[model samples]
Target: MFNKLDLSKELTGRRALVTGGTRGIGAAIAQRLLDAGAKVVVAARTRSDDTPAAATFVAGDVSTSEGVEAVATQALAALGGLDILVNNAGGGRAFLEGSWTIPDKAWHDSFALNLFAAIRLTNAVLPALRASKAAAVVNISSAAATMPFGPFAHYGAAKAALEYYSRTLAMELAPSGIRVNVVSPGVISTPGSDEFARTTPGFSTDDWTRNIPLGRLGATEDIAEVVALLVSGRGKFLTGANYRVDGGMTAR
Candidate 1:
């Protein structure tokens, strides 16, 4: 039923930047965009061969202004211009002491990566995105933004604000033809998520699968596929929306 959507060259000639794209869901997104003929750029603090060999690598952290500036300059220079931006670099260290006793530095780091990084990077790329025929911005949020549990208040609060900011940003950028949206993924199996399964209380992927309506944890490819569609012409009419890729985890 979904086959009518021709994505053979949906992103041809496009320039895309995926932050924290060296691994996990970000890696999958980068690969999909590259396969669709986009000039993809993957950005992170470090480099490894695992990065899509075809995509240009921009090694810069997104958690600080200096890093963001470096990434913005290098990306624009490398790609000449940009059309798709995926603000997918966001994660927080555990509040080992206690959720309420989370350190000030942890809070600052969380906001920097989970919220402000996207803000700063988006502003830096606005001019370039504005010049494109159809620009798209997709922020990778977490299902925790709406359903928080156990020491995630800090991350959840930041992502919640991110969603609100994205909605407002969408309103402001619509006239300029830049679409802003959010993708909230839930329990996707990745190296980063492997620890959660073992550490987080009762967070067994095998058990959760039966509880999740889909009867399985999501794959990185699931998110990659949705993001591919969201940034392509197929989603030309969508903006200011928060899409959940959870397997009915939130429904229950």
Candidate 2:
């Protein structure tokens, strides 16, 4: 549950864009930024009831170059300029018998969604990002990148590339005062993950909890809170860093 009292004006006057912000973790992050006083544009292929009413919604996919351009254009037009960019549009295909059984298209689609989308969108919005006095880019990754789950090999590999890209981008943009960071989440409780758990064989939410030091799946709000802080002045000094919000799963 998100605490309404957690709102702050720390991001006042900032403009932000969150990809795949219609539902789940993306929705939570957009809402948190709005609550923190930032003008936000939420982009997705479709809008849902869960879409934050306070955010300007842009209907565009981020998985292709054209989609990335459309989304970046509309989001920039909506906000005038961008200060914070959250590349959160990402997901893996259904669980396969093994990585070898996964088709070539699945690998391409995985990289398109998890890696290329962020790369293209960042390139599209580079001008606006560079123009801001306090710019930040937060790329959402996954614990699978480090843990390397056999069933989600493509996803893990793409996220691993994204993390490396983010670090290198951070180094290149540091002198310009732009900050880039990665947030890698563990098994999180969301409608998408819930459905995946139910449909995938040999994957149990209970089993996941037993391995987590916190003894529970993470909430979307948990990821949202960290994102809000990272995009705000509170995380001004942080760049090229990966914050794993995994309840100590990676620590173990």
Candidate 3:
């Protein structure tokens, strides 16, 4: 069934960037894109203290304007031009607090990390993305954006903003041939997720798997494969769309 959509080698000669690429979904996407023949640059505030062999790492936080500038400068220097940009760098654990208990600073901080980071990075690299034939932006959103669990309201709100922003950018950039899209994933199993699993009350592995119609917690590859398709030529005509990798979570 999948053979008809081969799309193999569709990413050859392309240059890709994956923010928060040191681990989890970002790392998986970076590896897969490289396997498909795209040169990749992985960026985050810290290098994996563990994976020394991970993709060429560029150390820069996306929370500040200066950090954003550093990432953009390093990326352009490494790739000469940018083709596919995957904004995949972010995570938050504070969810039990009500909106009244949530500080204004925390809410704004979440937006900085989850929403504004992608916006600043995209803005800085617009020129390079504009210069490429396959220029595209892939914002990694969350199923929570729609689900909006009470504890993680701020995180969900930011992701929701990301989804809307990506859609808006798609229309504005469509005339310029720059495609912008979003990938909304359900919970995926990763090292970053392990702590969430252990700490988040009642969030057992079994619970997560059972909640999904597919009956399994997603592997990083599960999300990575879809991302590859979107950034590749196979998804050339796709823009302003949210491709959900959630295991029927949002569908429910």
Maximum-lDDT candidate: 2
Question: Tens-digit lDDT track for model 1 on 45-126?
Answer: 9976668889899989899999999999999999999999999988875664457888788788899999999999999999
What lDDT does model 1 reach? 0.89
Model 2 stretches with alpha carbons more than 4 Å out: 1-7
Per-prediction backbone clash count: 0, 0, 1
Per-residue lDDT of model 2, residues 9-28, tens digit only: 77899999999899999999
Best prediction by TM-score: 2
Q: At residue 206, what lDDT does model 2 achieve?
A: 93
What would the TM-scores of all predictions be?
Answer: 0.94, 0.96, 0.94
lDDT of 3 by residue, 78-115 (tens): 98889999999887766575556667788888899999
Supply candidate 3's per-residue lDDT for 21: 87
CA lDDT, candidate 2, residue 133: 99
lDDT of each: 0.89, 0.93, 0.86
**Candidate 1 or 2, higher TM-score?**
2
